[model samples]
Target: MPAGLVALALGGFGIGLTEFVIAGLLPQVSRGLAVSEVAAGWLISGYALTVAVGAIAVTAATARLPRKPVLVGLVVLFVIGNLLSAVAPNYPVMLLGRVVAALCHGTFFGLGSLVARRLVPPERASRAVAVMFAGLTVSNVLGVPFGALVGERWGWRATFWAITGIGVIAAAAIATLVPYWAGEVPAGGRAGKVPAGDRTDSLRAQVSAFRSTQVWLTLAATALGYGGMFGAFSYLAYTFTEVTGFSSTDVAWLLVVYGAGLVAGNMAGGRGADHNRDLTLIVSLAGLTATLIAFGLLASSPAASVVLVFLTGVFGFASVPGMITRVTDHAHGVPLAAGANVSASNIGNALGAWLGGLAISAGLGYTAPLYVGAGIVLLGLAVMTYAAVRQAHARETHSSPNSARSPDRKASM
Candidate 1:
């Protein structure tokens, strides 16, 4: 409800638009730049790769800096990138613009989540994250379509010009609304325990948090769980039009339905995670696995495909809040964990898209990607179950009396 949260969401909206709108405008961009279609596609892949690297490297570099200023600077960088894209006369220049914009992408989400959590009580931390991410979902539902429309009416450069305007607005809002103290600590943080003059925000300190086995497990779970759904989603247009017999135009509307589901699932997932983080993640992954398999079986039926695609969005995104929460929780206040989690998610994105493409090129049917996706999600479920069991065992070991007593010295004591 805070104006600051709205500003953060606006920033998210702008960044999300930059990331996805290109997919719809790829053809226009390719022709404009006089490049091969495959080369234009690198804009997306290169941006993604930059985001993954920047998520960790940039976040670590700025771990010791004030978060508000970092966010504001990142938005300024975003604006510059869009301006370059709007005026780019060659393919290489456009590629440079995308790379510039991407360097700030993951760090924004990572730092934004931390700031969002700081704005509220621990009980509502995940919900705050959900609110910020809502902007991302809305961008998919509205922004991508609008960008495509603008490109069709004018030129691809015109769309980037509009996005540049968005970046300006987001930067202004963030600079005006977000408080400096939002970067200091959460409501229940170690503020008093650490001296103001002797604060520890070094990269080495942040990296030490990875010493926890639970953190590694959570990262793996994020990569696998998120990858599973994206594998199917990457080829959704083909499945809907070719496999389900929907018209090309109908595929666009169906994507809107899936986007709507994403919005709903994001909100619901946040609330559920607030109550029980681990259980929410497990259920979401399990549900996604089932939904994908069912989708594969019913791909030929238009009605079933429509219903199942929406369900896939719901189950797929429902794990997100829990995933972010789990990573930060296990990190025990480490600054880089949130950024690392962002990197992990992007890694999953690349993996899913590649794996799904492989299934299609192997001469399997369009529905085959969905089956492969289901199997990947099943692997995620197995990993999560193991994490849960390990957690339970650690708790049991800590609670046992023998854990506290020295056997050689104290039989009675």
Candidate 2:
């Protein structure tokens, strides 16, 4: 592995830590800020929404720019955002800090994926991307827990400061260590030239990727699929404590086990995606839904809860790289749009959480969110499956004799 990929992973670590550490300290933050616990939850929604929006817009605007500057700029925004959150005397200002940090979140990952693909050979691309994403999986395993401790021992603001410093270090890692790879066309792309009046590679090359039907479906699938998981997960700490009757401290350890599952799933997804992107996606999506349902039903039992939560993590995160790879595989040369897909994932987070919250607020039980999550992921499977079938039929139809004889007709599947 090259040093640049390591730097990119470090950047991902900082981003992931900044994104999730707030959940661990929400109670402290709410008490200190004198806000309702519900109100404090906005920090999560606010950051996620901002990141989702920023991911699409920023990646598009900066799509043509050099990777190094963009990566550095994102970390700067991240550091500044955390610093502001650290010192905010008011909840509003703290949210503003989160939004600021979120603006850079999607763009960084999007660009980082592109960078990862370019850094190594084609066969190694999936693993390269996985290495960078290890930072994300590891954050769940390490960063969130450590941040929670920092907030507990020192102060919540101190935790943000620590994260801010980590952002700085990540920035340094990218700037000094990572090689400056100018964003270019991927290798083995746009090849075999406009075959017999066909333009597979050139189809709507300049059109807005967000506007494509397939892209829209893919994004919707992502938003719903992930929203389902995070919705229940956001409340896992609550469920394990009150429902399963575990000690407060034990929930933390349970989360560690969940994080371990995320790491395992992430690696599995990475390798699986390389062999069969679509198959990996289908399997992971279906597994995620099943696991959430299993977790919701069995979580009342302590031993069962532990087993289900870990399984949920494994099945849930196993989709990450495959989700991304599928989108980019279709996208080919359109790397920015690929990044926008990352934004789509976060959007799913916000939607799933909000929808899940509605079920809980309506006097539905805690397990409602898990069922809701399972439903969202199932919806993604349906959409992706439709796309898969459509692509297959289209391929078959285009290969037919009459269609091939028509000179002006473009091939589509």
Candidate 3:
């Protein structure tokens, strides 16, 4: 692996840390900023909203710009956001800082995915993405805990200070290490890479990608498949306590176990996707749907619940690489489409959480979310099947004898 990938992962680490760490420090931030708990909670929702918007807008705005400089600029924005948060004097200021930082999240990952894929063989594209996302998993497993510890020992502001330093280091690494032509195909195509054709700076060009049926299907599958998995996870703590009969303290360790499963699954998913995109997605979603339903049915069995939680993480994240490749393939390698895919996932996150909350509010048992999640994922599978059928039909039409005789087809050939 190239050392540059490590640099990208480092940046991902800092970004992921700031995102998750806020959850742990909400009480401290609320008290420090002299705001109610609900106001402080906006920091997370606001960040998610900003990320969804920035993923498309920022990525499209920077489409004509050189990638390396764009990456460096993003890290700088992250540094400034963290610095402001470290010194924020009021609730509004802290919220402003979070929004600033959130603006770069989706675009970075979207562009970074392309950059990472260009860094290696086409066969290794998925693994490159996995390595980058590994940093995100590590942040959840390690960075969040350590960040919370710093907030407890020093102050919540201290944690932001530390993240600011991380951002600075990551910016330096990206500026110094990532090549200017990281994703550009060299002359003679010796790189075995497809050049990212044409600049997509115009909003019209970006919007045109949505006209493709595959793009829409991929987006729907992403929203439903990922949403279903996260829906169950969003209510994991409640399920553990009420259904599985785990204590509050036990939930923490079990969550760590789930996070570990995520890291392992992400890596494995990347490798599997490289070999077979469709099979990987099908097996992953089907497995996730089954796992969630089974967990719901066996909620009373503590032993089964622990194993199922871990499996949930595994099957849930295992679909990411396949989903990304599917959208990008259909978009003719448009980076903005990739960024929009990230936005779709965020939409899925909100949708899943909302649906899970609805189940709980309906006076349903804690296990009800799992069943709801399973049904949503099943819908994703249905969409995936439709996409496959459409793809096959398109392929057959292109290869049929009559189409081969067409003047346009002959000229292109």
Candidate 4:
């Protein structure tokens, strides 16, 4: 792996920590800012919504700029946003800070995926992307817990201050480490002199990539598949306490176990996807669906629930690398498509949580979310199966004698 990937991973860690640590400190924020708990929760929802929008908007807006500089700028934006949150005197200001910080979330990962792939050989691209995402998994495993502890001992504001410092470090690291040519497209043998016309064409190409059915299918798969796991996860605390009979304290530790599974699964899945992208996705989704079903059926058993939680985390995240890679592959490496994939994943998260909440509101038990999640993932599995078949058919058609009649058929597919 390139040393620059370390910088990207650090940026990912800081961003992930910023996004997730708020959950543990919502009460502190609520008390300090004189806001209701429900209002404080909007900080999270607002950030997510902004992420989905900014992923595509910011990425497209900056498509003409050099990648390394843009990355550094985004991290600088992250630092400023966190700093704003750290010192905000009111709830609205804090929400503004979150929205500002979130503006960089999707774009960072989307562009970072493209940059990470460029840092390594083609065959190792998926693993490279996984390395970048490892920071996110590690944040769940360690950063969130540590940030929560910091919030408890100090104050919630202190956590944001810490994240601001992290953003600064990430910004400096990215500026110093990532090569200037990281995302540059040479123009007429010139290294970085992309003409205005070429820039316009680049934007057009990105928009045009969406014409492929496979691209849309991959994005849909990312949304539904990822949404399923997140939906169940949104209600996990209830399941742990009301259904599985674990104490509140145990819930924290149980989450650590689940995070451990995420870390393990992400790395393993990355490697597996490098070997076979479609197969890894199929197996991971199938495994996740089965795990959610098992978790729902066995939630009353403490031991079984524990095991299922870990498995759920494992299978849920294991699809990420393959999902991102497949979408980018189908779109011919358009950065906008990758951003769209990130947006889709966030949309999935929000949708899954809402649906899961509805099931609980309908008087379904805590396990209802798990069953709901499983059903959603089953749909994703079906979509992915269909996509794989279509992709296979396209490849076969390209290799046939009819290839001459349509040179762009493979690209269109």
Candidate 5:
């Protein structure tokens, strides 16, 4: 692997830490800022919303620019956002800081996926993407916990200070290490020249990737598949405490177990996808659905809950690399398509959380979210299956003698 990938992964770690560590410090922030817990919670929700919007907007705006500089600039924005958050004097200021930081989240991952793929052989594309996402998994397993520890020992502001420093380091690493030509494939077959087109044409070409039906199907699959797991995850604390009989402290450790599963599953899934993309997606989604069902049914048993939690993390995240790769593949590696997929995933997260909340509000037990998640994932599996079948049928038709003579034969799905 190139050192550029390491820089990308470090950037991912800082962004991921900034996003998740705040969850653990909400109480402290609420107290410090003299705001209610609900208001402080908006810091998270607001960041997510900004990420969803900015992923597409920022990525599109910078589509014509060199990728390395864009990445560096995004990291710089991340640093400034955290700096603001660290010194925020009021609730509104902190929320503004979070919004600023979040503007880079989706775009960074979207662009980073493209750069990571370009860094390695075509056969190793999925694994390269996985390496970058590994930073995110590590943040969950290590960064979030340690960041929370820092907040507890020093102050919540101290955690933000640490994250700001991380952002600065990531910015410098990206500037110094990432190659200038990464993700900058030009139409003239040149390494450094801008793609041969006016800015409008370049933007149109990126947007044109969405014309493929397969791209839309893949994006839908990504949303539903990821949403199912996120929905169940949104209320995991309640289920762990009220249904699984775990103490609050124990819940944290159990999450670490789940995070461990994320790391293992992400790396393994990437390797599997590189070999057989469709098969990997099918197996991982099926495994995730079954795990969610089992977890819901067996939530009352401590041993079963512990095992299922880990399995849930494994199966849920195992599909990520394959799904992202599939979308980019279907879109022919367009950066806009990558950003759209990221937006879809965030939409899925919000949708899942909302639906899960409704289930609990309807007087269903805490385990209701698990069942809800299972049903959503099952739908995702069906969509993926349909997409695969359609693509196969398209290939068969294209090869048929009768279809070969037809001028109106559709593009492959």
Candidate 6:
């Protein structure tokens, strides 16, 4: 990988930190701000909502700008968001900082994928993107747990302060290390590789991406699929503590195993996607649904619960690349459409949280989110399977009588 990839990874790291760091600091923040836990949860909801809005709008507005300056601007937004969060004097002010930070979330991943593609050769684009996203997975494993620990001792404000410093370091590294490409292909491309000479082509010209139904379906998959995942994951610490009887310290260690699973899943998905995008999506998803349901059922035993959570992370996150590629494949020319998919992901995040809360309000057990999550994911899987079958049938209808003998590739479920 190029040194420039390091800078991209740094950007990913700051994003990773900002998104999950609040998990650790939530109790502290809720106490300090004199707010109920439910109200304090707005910090996450507000951010995810804002990010979903900005991912498409911001990325589209900047689609034609020079790559280097745009990336720099994003990093600037990242720094300011963290600084604002770190130093807020009141809860409202703190929410304001979070909103600012949220604006950077979707656009960075969208643009960052573009940058990663340009920094490496054709065969390695997916791997390149995975490496950058690894920063995010690492956050789940290390950043959230440690941030919680820091807040436990140093106060929640200090956690944001440290994140702010990381943002600064990330911005500096990006400015120094990333190469200036006056014209490079946007990282998210349709199908296979595009030539270097074509790298600087205008996103305006690729308007066809918006016209594809497959793109929209894939984007919906991201929202619905991840919504189910977060529906369970958002309340993980609470569940582990109450249901599994793990102490605070043990919760952190279990998350480490989850993180390891996430890391492995991302790498494997990249390799798997490059081979067959459809198959990768189907396999990852079926596994994800099974694991989530299993976690809910098997919570009776510490050992069973531990293993289920690990599999949940592994299967759940593995779909990320396939989802990304699936959207890009359908997005062909529309860079903003592709970018919009990132925001769709956060939208799912918020939706999942809301539905999960609904289950608890209705007096379901602590494990209700798990079952709720499984049902929702199964719904998403059904959508994908339907789309795949319809697409296959359409293809079959178009084939010539002579060519109809061609091998049938059943849509992956």
Off by over 4 Å in 3: 183-204, 405-413
lDDT of 5 at 267: 90
| lDDT per residue (tens digit) for residues 1-413 in model 2 | 78888999999998999887888899999999999999999998788878878987787676655778888998999999999999999999998999999888988887788778778887766777788889988998876688789998998999999989989999998898777753443333445322343322233442433344555666667776787788888788778877888998897789989998888888898888788776777888899988888888887899999988888888788777776765665555465666668887777777887888898899887788888889888998898787666665666776788686323122120
lDDT of 1 by residue, 1-413 (tens): 88888999999999999998998899999999999999999999999999999999988888888899999999999999989999998999999999999998999998898888888888988888898898888887776688789999998899999999999999999989988898763323355422244333554447656776777788888888778888899999999989899998898789888888888888888989999888888999999999999999999999998899899989888888778877777665556888999999889888988899999999997888899889888988888888877776666665688787323211110
Worst 10-residue lDDT window for candidate 5 reads: 186-195
Q: For residues 223-271, could you state the per-residue lDDT of candidate 4 as single tens digits?
A: 9998999999999999999988999889888998999899888888889
Candidate 1 local accuracy as lDDT? 0.85
Task: Name the lDDT value of residue 349 in candidate 2.
Answer: 79
lDDT of 2 at 46: 83
lDDT (Cα atoms) of all candidates against the true structure:
0.85, 0.79, 0.84, 0.87, 0.87, 0.76
TM-score of each: 0.93, 0.88, 0.92, 0.95, 0.95, 0.87
* Predicted structure 1, TM vs. truth: 0.93
lDDT by residue for model 5 (1-413), tens: 89999999999999999999998898999999999988999999999999999999998888778788889999999999999999999988899999999999998998899899888998998899999999988898876587789999999999999999999999999888889888564452223222455232176667666777888888898999889999999999999999989999898899899898889889989999999988898898999999999999999999999999999888888888888888877766667888898999999999999999999999998999999999999999999888877777787777888876323222463
Please identify which of the two predictions, 1 or 2, would achieve the higher lDDT against the true structure: 1
lDDT at 63 for candidate 6? 76
Model 1 deviation from native, Cα RMSD in Å: 4.0
In model 4, how large is the Cα lDDT of residue 276?
91
- Model 2: clashing residue pairs? 223-348, 228-373, 394-413
* CA deviation > 4 Å runs, candidate 6: 31-39, 182-208, 388-413
Model 3 poorest 10 in a row by lDDT: 185-194
Against the true structure, candidate 3 reaches a TM-score of 0.92
Clashing residue pairs found in predicted model 6: 114-187, 184-199, 185-199, 206-333, 209-331
lDDT over C-alpha atoms for residue 15 of model 4? 94
